[model samples]
Target: MLSLLTDQQALPEPVGPLTMFGPDFPFAYDDWLAHPAGLGRLPEHVLGTEVAVIGGGLSGLVTAHELMKLGLRPVVYEADQLGGRMRSASFEGHPGTVAEMGAMRFPPSATALGHYLDLLGLSTAPFPNPLSPLTPGTVVDLNGESHWARTSAELPTAYREVADAWEKALHEHAELSMMNAAIRRRDVAGIKAIWNRLVPKLDDVSFYGFLSSSPSFASFRHREIFGQVGFGTGGWDTDFPNSMLEILRVVYTGADDDHQRILGGCQQLPLGLWDYSPGRMAHWPEGTSLASLHDGGHRPAVTAIDRVGTGFLVHDKEGVAREYPAAVFAAQNWMLLSKIRCSESLLPGPVWTAVERTHYMGSSKLFVLTDRPFWRDIDPATGRELMSMTLTDRMPRGVYLFDDGPDEPGVMCLSYTWNDDSLKFAALPADERLEVVLGSLAAIYPGVDIRSHVIAPPVTITWENEPYFMGAFKANLPGHYRYQRRLYTHFKQDGHASGHRGFFLAGDDISWTAGFAEGAVTTALNAVWGVLTHLGGTTAAGNPGPGDVFDQIAPVELPED
Candidate 1:
C-alpha cells in the first residue's frame, strides 16, 4: 500500500505516538536493542564460535551483526548482493540520485528498524505520498477522467464518500479506535485481549470480506473506489484476498502512516551496519565489525545444507563446505523449496508445511531519471504544477515524482504496481515498460511531454521474476494464521526435536507484519535470541529476551481441528 487519499474529517478519532509493537506477538524489540545490558551473553566456550548465516539481506545482516556482538563469529553467505530487497540502483554517473528498485517509503512506526537507521546516522525525508502534506499535488485518474487535488478536501464528493465509508467500516467492525489506543500505549494486555478475540473470529475472513460485512461499505462502488485509492498508502484492492488479521495488524500498529524515505538510499542501513563497530561487545575486540570479520566481503551463494551428525554442514557455490553448531536462514522462505537443497530432517513436518503454504505478492517498479524538476513547472491556465503524484486505473497504476533540485537530475517512478497489475509488465523489457508507462501518463496529462525530460535509460525490477526472490513479500491468505504462526515461532526451537533445534528462520515473511522492514528487524532479533539460547546463553538479569518472555506474550494460537 503506497498511495492514500485521506479526508481529515472522514478519518477516525486521532491516536498518537504509535509504534510497530505487535498486535500479534507484542514485544518491544526497540527497547531490547537499546538495553545497555546487551542482548545476551554466550557461554565462554561458545564465544568466538562460527555461526553460518545464509542470505546477506537486512534480516541476515541484523542476525549476523547481533550474533557478532554476542561473541559468536558469523559467516554470512549471500546468494545475491547485500541489502537484498532494500536495493538502491544508482543511475550511471549519478551518485545520490537512485532508483529504489525495492523498499522506498517507511513508516515512523518501524521503531525497531529506526534504531539501526539512527545508529547508522542515516537521514529521512517525508516521502511524497498522494495528497500528503509533503506532496505538491496529486492526480487521481480513473474511468478516463483526471481529478487534480492538493488535499483530500479538494477531491470530488465521491472520493470523500469512499474515504468516509472506509473509516466507518474500520470503527464498526475492526474496533479501530480500541486497537489503535492499545498499540499507541503499548498495552500488551489490551493488545492481546482485542487481538486474541478477533484472531479466531477473523482468521478466515479476507480484507474484502471484512469490508463487505460492514454496513458502511455496503455500496460496491464505495469498495471499488476505496480499493483503488486506500486511506494510508495507494490502492490496495490487490490485497483484498489477504486475511483480515493481516490488514488489522498493519493498521493497528500504524505501519501504513507517516511514511518517509531514506535521504540517500535504504540499502545504506545494511551496508553501514556491515561496517559499523559497536562500542560494546563481548568476545570480539574493539572496532570489530561484520565487514572486518569477513575480510570486507562475504562468501558466495549457499548451494546445499545437510544435517551432519549433531551440527549442520553448509555447502557454498565455490565448493566451500563449512560446519556450524547453529545456522540462520534469513533469505526468502521460498528459497528453501526452490533455490537451495535442504535435508528433510532440518525442520518438522508442520513447519515445512507452513513454509510451503506461504503466500507472496508480486510487485514491479520502473524508474527513470529526468533532466530537471520539470514537474514543478506551473501550468498557466490551471495554476497547478505541470505534473503531480499520480494514481490511476491504467497499466502504470501509480507514478511518483522525486525532485532533488531544479538543476539536479530528478527521479520518477514511472510505475509501481502489485499482483495482477505488476504481472502485466513483468514480461516486458525496461524500454517497453517505459513506453507503456509514458502512454498511460500521456492520457492523464494530455499536453505534457513527460518523455522529453528523460535523461537516462529506464531501470526496472520485477521481484517475482528475480530468481533469488520469487515474490515481493508475504501476505497471508484466509485461514493462514496457523501457518504464519508456525514460521514466526520456528526460531523458538526448544519444543522441536534436536535436529530442527539448531536451524533458525528470520525475515519479514517469518513475522506477523510481513511487508514492512520492521518485521525483518524484529524477526532477526528473535533469531538472534534463539541462537543465543541454543548455545547456552542467557539474557542479562532484568532484561529478558523474546524467548524468555515467550510463554507470557506468545502470539494467539487457533486450534488445528
Candidate 2:
C-alpha cells in the first residue's frame, strides 16, 4: 500500500518490507555491508600500495574508508571541501540554524545509506514535506488561487483527481504494486523480470510523454496540475523531459517516500567516516583511520591522469604526480571531460561516450533564518496555522518551514526550484532571491508579514553555477538509458581492455538512481570491490560482492541498434 504521497499511515507493513533494493541491478547492498564477513581481502604485496581516489565526496570517502580497512592506502584528491554536496551553511549569529544548500531530504528506503548513518550514530526526523503527517498543515497555490488543507482528503476535487490519476497511471503502466512487492521480498528474479521488460519499452518515452499516453491523465489540466505538485515531493515539472524509465526507477524503489532529514546535518557522515577507525582492519593497526592515514589533510584537485606501466599516473593541481596500480574516479563524471585531464585509454569508448552524454538537472534553493517558529501561530479569524508547508506554480515552486522549537530560531527554505524554474533565479543575488520568494508568499498569505520574522540575511545556492558541481544531479533523458548503462557497468572491468581495467567509476551519477545518497554509497561499494579485484584480491568465502556475482544480477543489456 505505498500510496502516491508516501503516507506510511495509510498502509500496513508486509512481511519483508520494501527497501532500496533496486528494480535495476537488484543486489542486496545493505545486506552486503551488514554481513559479519568483511567486504573483501587484498594480497600481501598490494596491501600497503597507494590507490589514487579522485574527489573527496561521499563516494570517494566510502571508497577510501573501505580501501583503508582492506590494508590499501587511499590518496583522496578534493577540489573543494570534504562533504561535497552535503553542505550545511549556518547563519552568522544562529548557532544551530543551518540552511541545507544541497541534498536536504532522504527516504528510509535507502538502507545502504542508513547503514552508515547507524554506524555514525546519526538520527533522522520526518521532514516537513507538503501533506506529510509531520507537517502541521499545507498550502496549495495554483493560478493565483490558494487552498489550505491538513490532509489529502480536504483538498479540492481537482487536486484529488490529479492525485488519483497519477496513482492509476503508475499502477496501470509501471506495474507499481508488483514491483513493490518483489522489492520487499528481495525477489531478484522478479525485479529483473519486470524491469528488463520495461527498460526496452520505456527507454525512449519521456515522463511527460508517459502522462500524455495514460488514459487516466487524458486531460491536459490534470497533467499540468500533477507536474506542478507532484506526489511524495513537490513540483517535478522540472523532471518532465527525463526518461520514463528514470521516473519508474525512483517510484519502483520508493526513493521519494517517507522522507527524513539527518540531524546535525548530513555532512557529518563523510566527516565521521574520515575520522572513524574500523574495529577490525586487515593489515593496518586498530587505531589507524582514514584521518590518521592522511595526517589530517588530503591532496588538492586532480589535474590529469595518464597510463603508466601496469598502473596509472595521477597529477594534482599542486603539480604533484603519483603513480598507482589502480585508481577510482568518484567525482562528477563530466569532470573527466573538462576539469580533469583523463587519458583516452583510461576508459572504454562507450564509457567515455556515456560520460559525455550524462544529463544533469539544475537546482536552486533560497533559505533564511527566522526569529522564531512564527508559522505555528494560529489565526483568530480562520483558526489556521499562520503559514504552512507550501507548494505552488509560482516562482517559489516549494517552500518548507523547519522549526527546532517554539523558543529556538526557525529556518525557512523560502524557495526550492529545479531546471528551467531554477535557472530563472540563477542570475539573482541572495537578497533578490529572498525578495522574489517573499513576494510570492505574500500573495498566498495576504495579511501575514513573513518578512518581519526574518532575523538574518538570506542564504542561497544555484548548483549549476558551482565549479565542482555543474548541476544538482543526474537525470537521464529519453533514450539515454544506454548511456547510463555503460557508465554503471564500467566497474566490472573484465570486459574492458587491460589498460582500462585499472580505472573504475563510482558516484551517484554512475548509479541507476541518481540524486540519492544510497546510490552514492552503493556505487562506492562497487568501486571498492573493483579495486580489490584489480589487485588480485577476492571476497571472503560465502560473502560474494556485487562484482563476484556479476553475470547473474548485472543490469539488463538493451541492444544499441
Candidate 3:
C-alpha cells in the first residue's frame, strides 16, 4: 500500500491514527479484536453460558478462544479436522515434512490473523514466491519457452513487457496508486473516495474486460501473457471471469504479495490457540484452554439446526441435541444445504440466496518429500539451476519448494492449479496425478529427472472433491456483488424478527474479503459482537466492536434487483 502512495510523489502524514473504514464504518476491527484491553467483558449474567460453535475451523476456534476469555463456554463441532481450509498435511513417514494443501502463503496486511500468530509466539519467513527476490532464483515457462532470472531484468523481453504493463494498468485503470496511499496512511475518507468509485464500476466488469480496456496493455498477446505469468501469484485466467473488484481488493490489500508461510505449517496457529491458556478465564476453572475444555477433541459434526423458542436446538451426528441462546454457524454455506439441515425460517430469503449463491473456486496441489533442494543445483550445460521456483502456462501452473535445511530434507509442491486446472484431476487417483505432474515437469526441465529425487509417494489434494471442503476458497463472480454484500452484512439485519437473531454467520465465505484467513478472522469477530449484544453485553467505553457502530460503517449496499 505504501508503494502505491508514493508512486508519483509523497503525501504528508496524517495528524493522528489513520482509520481505514472511514466514519460510516468507523471501527478499526483489527486493532479492536486484538486490543490489549480486550473486546469488552461479557455481563456477569451471560458469563459461562454455553454457546454452540459449529465447525472447529479457525473462525470457530478464535470465537471460542475470545468468548472463553470473556467467561463463555463454547461447545464446538467439526466433521473433519480442527483446522478447516487452513489444513497442512504432514508426510506419512517424515515427521516435519508437510504439504500445505490449503492456504500456504499469508500476507502481513492481514493483521487479524497476525494478532493470533503473534499471541501464539510463532515465527515466519518470506514465502519463496516465483520470480520473488525472497528466493535464490525463479523460472518462467511460457508458450514453450523458459526464462531464468533472479529478478525481472534477467527475464526475456516479452515477460518484462507483460510485467510492466500490468503494473501500469493497475495504477491507471484500477486507481491502485491512490488507493494504496489512502490505505497505507489509514486515511478512511481517502480510501472510501477511491474505493467507492471502483466498487460500483468494477463489481460488474470481468478482469479480462478490465485488462482489455486498459491502453497500457495495447497487445492482446501481452494481456494473455499477463494472465498466464502474473507478477505475483501467476496465471489469473481462471479468475478472469471473476469481478474486477475481487482482483483490485486482492492487490490493494497486499493479499497477493509480501506473503509469508508459517514455519511448520499454518495449522499451528489454530491448534496453538486451542491450547494456549489466556491470561484470564470466565468458567469451570482458571488456566483452562480450548483443548482442555473439550478434553483434547472437538464434538461430533452438527447435523441439524432448528428454531426452538427463544434459543435454537442443534443436533450433532451422534444424535445428541442441545439448545443454546445463540449459535455461530462457522461452516461453509454449502453445508447448510448438503451436510446440515437448516430451518427454512432461520434466515430471510435474501440471506439464504446469498449463502446458496456463494461461489468457491476449485484448487489442486501435489506435494512431494524430496531428498534435497536439488532444484537449486547448477546444471553445467544450461547455465541454470536444475530448476527454480517455476511458473508455467502448462498444467503445473505454479511450483514451490519448502527447504527445511540444505541437507536434511525438502518439500516440493510439484503442481498447484486452480479452477479449471484443478478440476482436470478431480477424479484422477494420486498415482495418476503424480504421473501427469512428473510428465509436465519433465517437459519444463529436459533431463533433470525430477522423479529420481522423490524419496516417498507424493501427496495430492483437490479441495472441491474433498467432502468437508466442496471447494478451495470463496471467490466472487462477475455481477455477484449484491449477493456478496448481503452475506457480508447479514448480521446487521433483523436476526430476531427474521427468525435468525440467535443464529449467526461467520467464516471467510461471509466476509467482504473472501478466501483469506483475514476474512475468516474478521467475520468471526463480527459473530462475537453479534452474540455479545444479543446476550445483553456491551463493548467497553473506549473500544467499540463492528456491531457497536455498524449503522455508520456498514458496507455500501447495492439496490436489490
Question: Number of the top candidate by lDDT?
Answer: 1
| Candidate 3: residue 156 Cα off by (Å) | 2.0
Once fitted onto the true fold, the runs of candidate 1 whose alpha carbons sit more than 4 angstroms away are 1-3, 8-16
For model 1 the local lDDT of residue 57 reads: 91
Evaluation by lDDT, superior candidate among 1 and 3? 1
Q: Which stretches of candidate 2 lie over 4 Å from their true place?
A: 1-13
Query: For model 3, how does the per-residue alpha-carbon lDDT over 1-561 read when each residue is reduced to its tens digit?
Result: 322111223546734432223312335777796666678777787888999999888998998888788788888899999889889888878877778888888878787788899888899999988656667777778889877777766777776677667777888787876776667777767777777677777778998889888888889998887788775666788888888887877777677766799998989988888898987665558678988878988899889999898888999988999999999989888999898888887887878988888899999999998899888788999776788888888878888887977897889998999999998988898889989888988988889888888888888999899887799888888888888877877766444484667788999888777788888888898888888888887788778888877765566667665
Q: What is the C-alpha RMSD of each candidate to the true structure, in Å?
A: 1.7, 1.3, 2.7
- Arranged by TM-score with the best first, the candidates are 2, 1, 3
- lDDT for each residue of candidate 1 in 1-561, tens digit (9 for 90 to 100): 222656444445546478888888999998999998889898898899999999999999999999998999999999899999999999876766898998899999899999999999999999888888889999988888899988888998988888777777777788888887888778899989988989999999999999999888889988988888887878889999999998888887878877999988989998998999998889889999999999998999999999998789999999999999999999999999988899998889999999999999999999999899899999999998999999899988899989877988889998999999999999999999999988888889889998889988888999999999999999999999999999999988888888778899999999998889999999999999999999999998878999999999999889997
- Residue 399 lDDT (model 3): 88
Assess candidate 1 and give its TM-score to the true structure.
Answer: 0.98
Model 3 steric clash pairs: 24-552, 24-553, 25-553, 495-501
Query: Candidate 3, residue 390: CA error in Å?
Result: 0.6
lDDT string for model 2 (406-500, tens) is: 99888999899998989999999999998888888888988898888899988999999999899999999999988998888889998777877
